[model samples]
Target: MKRNALYAGFFAILSLPVFSADRKPNVLLIVADDLGYGELGIQGYNKDIPTPNIDSIASNGTRFTSGYVSGPYCSPTRAALLTGKYQQRFGHEFNPGPPVAGNEPIGLSLAETTIGDRFRKAGYATGWFGKSHLGNTPEYHPLSRGFDEFYGFLGGAHSYVNAGAESNNPVLRGREIVKDPGYLTEAFAREASAFIERKKDEPWFVYLPFNAVHAPLEVTEKYEKRFSSITDTKRRHFAGLLSSLDDAVGSVLGKIRELKLEEDTLVIFIADNGGPTAQTTSSNGPLRGFKSQTYEGGVRVPFAIQWKGKLPAAKVDDRPVIQIDLLPTALAAAGVEAEADWKLDGVNLLPYIRGEKTEAPHDALYWRFGQQLAIRKGDWKLVKGPEANAARGGTAGKASTAGAQLYNLADDIGEVNDLASKNPEKFKELAAQWDAWNAQLVDPKWLPNRRAGARNRNSAENSAAPASKWKSGDSFEDDQAPQIASRAFTISARVDAAAPSGVILSQGGPQQGYSLHVKDGKLALSVRVAKQLSTVVSTEVLPAGSHQVEAGIAPDGGVTLKVDGKTTGEGKLASLIQKQPGEGLHVGNDGDAAVGEYTAPANFSGSVAEASVTLQ
Candidate 1:
């Protein structure tokens, strides 16, 4: 368990002989958030949402037909992917704490060595491109964990357009905030390509994880315009997002090819888990269940590997492969041997890929998150969920064992037909296996982030920033930016209070809009929309004095509202609730009450200033 002393000087010592140039290959692992099995062109998806670049990897190499991540959710799968072992061994069995409050302490244990740390020990220059939700604290940062360069946010998700979304804390470059203007996916790709260009002379391992198809459904006008033929709003946005992600993938592939690194680069593409079809119209096709479940659709995802001229081309493998395999596979490819004493759970897939080994790589794959549990041993899968026994949408009832269901994926991929009763013996065997796996897991290291805090304001303002500046006839349109935050107060402007001279809020995207309304002593704040009804809420009663009010992402991906640091109102958002797109900032209203124009509420407003928004 001792740290490799040579790791500190390896990045600078390019001449070190870790591998002969011909024996070592640079690794570029790309992972998408919440992407489904059938969402890509290689998987027989839409022709309009062409994924020529993503397909390029499959076309030239292997496309895993039954590829799977270790867990259905984001953080757990990432833990397995990075560690080459079951996350339950070290207790990272659920998503980390809320990214905003920095509350999630659950992280990959310091005792466990990461794949990047492995590469660093072998003299590889390591870098991480996007989405580091594995940990948020300084101790768990990529730089501290062997990655020489780190870009992208440290949270599970962020706004695609607004730099303020997630309060901007999650988006960073080597511990510094990077407000790179343009689409987040594209920015990640740009930085990745640049990173490769800069390190062409040395052996490198770049974990390029892209957060393209996740929530906030925000895409650039250019991408959206590409889908002018699609009328359904959700589908159109989803198509745009997929198209952009494809382009980003293509861009990275092209960079490798252009740099002549394709032959030397081992490229892998996978989704963190399955899609939340409700949020992004990502099609899971025939797979049953969405994300946050134990069904096949929740865990099985689109997986492909591209190592030019080395791996077989245009091939399909039906074996179930988990994300955990990547750790050992990459290490094996780099000619660095994994220690036997480490007790790694995954075996190198090179032997199987090379047609040297015929057996399946893993005997059983297991998952545990919150109250959910599942185990896939060969074709048999044992699962228990709140909705387990439902024939369609009906609940399986509250009885834990009565609610449990079993499916033979070899026979039914959709999981429509449960075989628990018909094949009681097989179900019992797999259920026993699942129990043994669950018994090994420690309790969830941290509960989901559900703290009460001011939403729509900079973290700096959360403590001490500028005072609120509200004015009549002022526009708060900019308050709707995905990243910009507006703080609400319970106390009225006091009528006698002086009005601020200028607008305190700075709105960005054109569609970003907001409003402050007062009716019968109740102050209502709302997100103004162009054609649709605005989302409004009544602030808690003002206590005859100044009081703060705010709402933003809850720890569990829900929306929470707070008045003076106390919970006031909360609502769950459909996955599509993203900030409006725009450029101009409106303080109170746009001065015009026409459609799409901000209308100033007649209520006398107070002074507002130092209003800001940020992404965490």
Candidate 2:
């Protein structure tokens, strides 16, 4: 391999001892988006995609077989990872929808400190390269959130190919959009490596979160050719994406080795959340459920760490661990003690990994994502949520949980067995503990990005007819809201779309109900049932005159949206809303929880003549 002039000045730092207290360790936090637990070769579940570089981090140091992320979705997990606290503690319980049911900023709460802040305060060169799902607004950019430099998109997921200013989510170099950011994953790898090389003289913390193997599964021609063996189109694309990620990891690791800084770096690898199998052909192995659910497959992910000479080699630590622990561990590696008032959910794992502690880092790990939640105390676990609620929503209603399932993770890692009946006491015990934990949490800072994450605090589940008709914008309480639990329903409205855009009528706030609105002058119906969103938008812009629009749902969950008796758009939901939406109807003007993309108090600029709902 040929070495360039930029690599010529790295000879002095080569001989630093692995366990030396003479210098602080640099941190490399690499996060993969929606990666399946079974995809990594070290997990021994997938034989298709080989992730040698990532697996080496496990082979060389510690791999937590029971590793879990705080949330089953992208933003929540990242928020916890950076802040070192449960996101729910600060009301960041769901992905930033429009405005939440309550008033809160659209990104991570500024009141809380982040890992980047901690490391930057410690005099380290901090940089974030890759997905910055924290917030898209200026206040939430990586630069504002503590990183000195940021090179990536600010949204949850971005286009891997057309990642320019023209894309909905464009690549950014600091605050400016990069006109041409070739192949985002590769760009991230390059940006991370470049940061290291540029800041080789000082301690640096790099948060590299690659949005690979996510949707819009496009792979470079080179990587596609590399994965030509796979017959399945989706699987082959997945393999290629996974391979690119692996190679990118290898390249960055190689950079460190080339600079002889491997011994001085504390490296951590984790999937942001489990893969969405249906969308990307990702495999969670035998674990039940996929992304956005509270299962081992959704929250439990492939986690590994490496510090070269300081940690054990090829060790599998089965103790339960979560992503929240990364901050304290990285800080400890840097010789900084975590302050007590920080109140972080994650613990310093280096002590436990170094054999200084015999017990697990945490005694109990808890999670709350609207309609679904879970708690794990040792081998016993209690969890419940709809399966694969892809559109992560947050409820404005009471936290209702009536069907909590219990499982012994040691015996049933797949979560196929229901031990709740056989272990009533155990279930009740975990439930009480969870209730206590849930009580300490606050309402969401904002709603879910999709109309989802509506968690009911009470243990009540009832089936009833929802408010079938409404003409006013009065907010119905969750309990009093229309109860459309797994039933077919229809929403119809006659409104003027003369104005630009606004919500004309909405039954459920988000993630679990339907919203009829105008966006960018186009009429659209957003139907969310069972936490999955199926949006149908009209092809043409709305005319000035009053238009009659109706959203019809079939008994089998099929949905169609019509404008003035013309079928403008159509979609199909997997199922009806499994539970009544907490944020009730806000017909005419979404005064409560936002129903669509518009902000709360989403008053229609155009007049709404009549609005109603029909349940079948």
Candidate 3:
């Protein structure tokens, strides 16, 4: 079917009233971070793990058997869920890094209207509780982005047990940093319950995104005792963490029951993305791959929706439904008409849920994560790059040499069988469709540093320079340079500053790299790995003359910066750059991408006399 026709049909179906015009049901959107598809007992993929509260959501509502998230990671899926559109369309295609000095604008674009905005316009109280990884800037805060009340950490991950003032990730009540309550999960549940209680008299939208089950596997005894029967250490810890999440769900549900608001509330339970099974010991069950890949185990998450008396209960929805659908679904439930200008990619699932439409809600679902690309139409799935093999925890063979693999999910849910050779016609069709769809998407706003074990060739050790004099825009080719390795190294340059600020020496891209640059007349050194940036800038500025600037990386990852012979700044990184940059080093500029927030190729306005790299 044509894309336009499919969308038109959806609009036509959604035009039918799903609820009474006089009453708009309160929306409770609960999203679990890195929740495995097999974690919930309702799925029957794992028998040992008991999730009675989470399972009750499906038992009392409709369980989606093939529920998928738009992205294979957290932030991207949240972006899609918020806008009811594919994140790629708005350039929110990757997880954004925390704000740095130069790179402060990383966040969801303000162009798109969010679900909170829509619901608020339709007369609803909007509250966001838990994780808000969309953005860290003041403008990107949940309160500014349509939510009236916000309480959560702005970054991706946080410690569940201890979120103290000194913690990297701290909990916030609105804009103020508050003391960490007893435990993070329970605190979030308490906040969610309060929001519901505060807005029970009127229509409200509560976006509860729990950071539980993500990482830092810390669990209190309250939940740890429930999973002591599991002998595996990591699995046992994961179970405990999951139990806390279940209790959180139960807390919110219990409140709804107590307030007698069950009939007037629309509750949705889903995972932001699939679990990182290897790291967290969270099982994807029969599915292959984990988070950060295009496989079913990465994107296909546990999803269910419940609305007492309004929708059927104990029904299994075998058709595929995506997180994007929630926006339009909620809007329809609230009796609000969605405008065509929104250009949402999701459909209202009311007709399908009501049994008014027998056809599937979507004709195709697409995913693009860095170099990996996948397209699923009906039961046939075509994947390019390492995702096909990465799901199996193996190195991905070259797609150009091996071609894209085709799999029929109906027969092989784990994606073990390759049907590319047997089904050439289907493979060709899916590939062509994927290409056409990809053509419409803009280049990613920011590309991740790593792609399924592949490192940037330009930043390899061989690409290093022994000694080179560089002009404004000149950059060295990627060679096997010993200094580029993650070890003790020193970079020193003798330069005459013609301009106040510019890059003196740099390697790598936005995701991971090291750069020594002059910013606002101050010498600054920045090292980035896995999107985390740490920098040390000199307290004093360079006085418009020839001077020697040097940066040293200790074996322990401690960084030291010196101007002439004196120490200017010092800091430490827990880890060094792992992936090489696609663009090699620059002596007088940053090359194609900036290591931090500075603009790309921040060309130097000075001349370099001599530059040398020494490795210990």
Output the worst ten-in-a-row residue range by lDDT, candidate 3: 392-401
Q: Which ten residues in a row are the worst by lDDT in model 2?
A: 387-396
1 or 3: which has the higher lDDT? 3
TM-score of 2: 0.74
Writing each residue's lDDT as its tens digit, candidate 3 over 3-107 gives: 999999999877643445577789999999999898899999788778899898898889999999999998999999999999988777777731222443678
Off by over 4 Å in 3: 1-21, 97-104, 165-168, 385-402, 449-455, 458-616
Quote the lDDT for 15 in model 1.
49
Supply candidate 1's per-residue lDDT for 383: 79
**lDDT values for all models:** 0.66, 0.78, 0.78
Cα RMSD to native, each candidate? 12.7, 8.3, 13.0
- Highest TM-score: give the candidate number: 2
Give me the runs in candidate 1 sitting further than 4 Å from their true place.
1-23, 98-104, 168-170, 386-402, 450-547, 550-616
Alpha-carbon RMSD, candidate 1: 12.7
- 443: Cα error in model 1, Å: 1.5
